[model samples]
Target chain A: MAITFPVEASHILMFARAVGDPNPVYNPASAPGGVIAPPTFGQAVAQFDPEYHLRPKPGQPWFGSGKTPSGVDKAPSAGGLHAEQHFEYLRPLRPGDVLTVEIKPGATWEKESKRAGKLTFRERIAEYRDQTGELVLIARGVGVTTERPVDQG
Target chain B: MALSASRIKPGDTHSETVVSNLTRTQIVQYAGASGDYNPIHTDEVYTTKAAGYPSVFAHGMLTMGLTGKMLTNYVGDGRLLKFGVRFTNQVWPGDTLVATATVTEVADLVVKLDVVTTNQDGKDVVRGSAEARIDP
Candidate 1:
């Protein structure tokens, strides 16, 4: 099952500022078309409650990952590593435009850990769309979950 | 002088100054501030033998943050359009990163930059590209 999240322009602006991106395009009052959001603004979308828009319907336990940050794993292994990420922008996100994000799992696999434990790699693709169903952005991310014996020191 | 798209030829180079007497505390602060708590980045033991890394390293994004800072500061605001990076190498504690950019392509309103971060040893720590739209 797929999950969707709703985002506010303020959150994106905050994120862009946090990353030190001071581009005026992210400024609502200064942007050219009265200023849209940043090109990378789609990053704020999450598959879980911290950003989830609507709860999954009953019997959709697969979509609920029990508070995992990305909502892709119910119990993420210890020592998660950010592997890679890619983003594509289709249209500018404007202020007052609410984004509906749809997340789809891309792939999941296991490998011998590079850090002396087992590792699980998971990738997901998220699509951000505006109220009128205009595609705004597409984000693909890969995460690494590390597992080591609890008693191994 | 501002480096406008029209002024940059295909091999033009851009450089920005950076200083770092990086402390362990700064590393931890970046981890907390960014919510990226990978143990190898915060814990020394895990980074060395456990993670097979030479030593505790700074967050890739933290270094990217420095690049972002320079880009905005250079463009003098209201001109940058998009920026992103792919992490290539680890930046260890106490290493000062110098970020540089080279013009790859130029359009009427856009300039593409091949940006890179290098340590004092001249080793590239991170490499990426950025696009800035010159405001008329």
Candidate 2:
């Protein structure tokens, strides 16, 4: 899937705050070339993905609770877990740089764990390109679905 | 300011307390900012009763984001060439996280680092490597 991500200074500020980074570089006026988005800021592209399952969309039945413990009668035993994340940056992303993100399935594998039972790992690769079609960042993420909730002990 | 190759070498390490007494509200803040609204990270009721967890936990991306801050602070803004991590453990509320980056190599005007983030118990929560541009 592909989504358009318009990087904005306000959004960068908010993200910086959320991550507790008070660096002056994230502020446009404080930085010479303009605010540079944080290295992991590319993950924010999820906000633009209309079909992202983690986000609840209007008119759709969300698995999250509303009136009951769960909105769905049969909610999965547990949600998928993020196993790994990697990023390669060709250049810094600045405010006003509109990027087109293309995500593709990379690999799939399985493993057995005593803590979580069977783990099905799925890898996703995302390419972020500027409006001019220049590749700015490449992100690879791995998600795992566990047969049961991880043993906290 | 960017790090200079001449000023750094293998074995050099930088560490910072990335987050102190992590809060659920801050987790929600990350979810809102990152647009990842997974109930396992926010809705305690759903996570405890429906999902079968002690409580809601922080998003893995949130921990990555927090760790990135320490990296950028050490390497300088906009200097990262690569960053990656594997989620080793779940981060929960009230946990204090400390991130550390150790220089593993420095050459060709670039520095490679081994990064790790640990919770109050000193248990590793995220571990990986990063490369950043450096000045001669």
Give the candidate number with the greatest lDDT: 2
Model 2, range B25-121, lDDT digits (tens) per residue? 9999999899999999999989999999999999999999999999999999889999999999999999999999999999999999999999999
Q: Model 1 chain B, poorest ten-residue lDDT window?
A: B45-54
The residue-by-residue lDDT of candidate 1 on A20-92, one tens digit each, is: 4556655565556555544444544442334233223445442222333233433223445555556555655
* Chain B of candidate 1 vs. true chain B, TM: 0.82
Q: Which residue pairs overlap in candidate 2's backbone? A: none
TM per candidate: 0.60, 0.98
Q: Looking at model 1 chain A, which ten-residue stretch has the lowest summed lDDT?
A: A62-71
Clashing pairs for predicted structure model 1, backbone only: A31-A35
Regions of candidate 1 where Cα sits further than 4 Å from its true position: A1-80, A90-97, A107-123, A142-153, B1-3, B23-34, B42-56, B74-84
- What does fnat come to for each candidate? 0.05, 0.90
Instruction: Write down the DockQ of candidate 2.
Output: 0.91
What digit string (tens of lDDT, one per residue) describes model 1 on residues B81-111?
Answer: 5566766566677877788888787888777
Query: What DockQ do you compute for every candidate structure?
Result: 0.15, 0.91
By summed lDDT, the worst window of 10 consecutive residues in model 2 chain A runs over: A25-34
- Output the lDDT of residue A105, model 2: 98
The deviation in Å at residue B26 for candidate 2 is 0.4
